[model samples]
Target: MKKKKNLKKIILILVASVSIFALIIFFCSFVMIYQDVKDNCLEAQKEYGDDCVDSLIKIVQSQSQTYRLKNSAIWTLGQLADKKALPFLYELDKSLLPQKKCDLDKYLCKYEVQKAIKWFQKGNITSWMYGNRESWH
Candidate 1:
């Protein structure tokens, strides 16, 4: 009986450890993806000038693009905080039903669009990586 308890405890510890490790890996991957998206946005702005905002908007609007790409573009728009993109953001927000649960596969980043809209509405832009808040208002 004591041996069975020990084995159960070991199994519980192992499962908890694996869960924590998996969470850490998931968050690390997410951070890397956000960084890459930010870099891509910066590079595009440098190469394309003001048109970069339009380009990102196009990506968000494109039905052919993957939801991941669309979400990245939505995040970039929030970071850019360009007033010109506000209308497009609003349109996107209006198009989606209120999400009771996050379904990125089905809704195509509806929550991200809402977040971007909130940033625009607040007239503030915050860096996703550095947490630097900039008031564009």
Candidate 2:
């Protein structure tokens, strides 16, 4: 009976150790992915220039298989939204992509353009505080 209890204890410890290891791996992967998304966002902003918003949207929409990538894409898109992208954003879907609108808008790849517009709207409110007050005069 004592031997059986010892074996069970060993098994339990092994399982716990494996679970902890898996958690550590998952957390490391998440951190790595987050950093990658941040880098991609910065790159999209810098390299794409006029195309950065569209490129970012495409990256987010295309990489929808991973929740981390998808979420980052959405966040990035929100950062770069523009009015020109709305029509395209409204058109995409999941069948063509993964996170489409109407479950289908994923096909349209202008997500960042749409998102950037929204960000612009919000940013515009603060613009008034910083710009030349003399310009109005």
For candidate 2, the per-residue lDDT at 55 reads 59
Off by over 4 Å in 2: 49-55, 58-88, 94-137
Score each candidate by Cα lDDT.
Answer: 0.71, 0.51
**RMSD (Å) of each candidate, 1 decimal:** 7.4, 12.2
- Per-model TM-score, in order, reads 0.56, 0.43
Write down the lDDT that model 1 would get.
Answer: 0.71
Question: Which numbered prediction scores highest in TM-score against the true structure?
Answer: 1
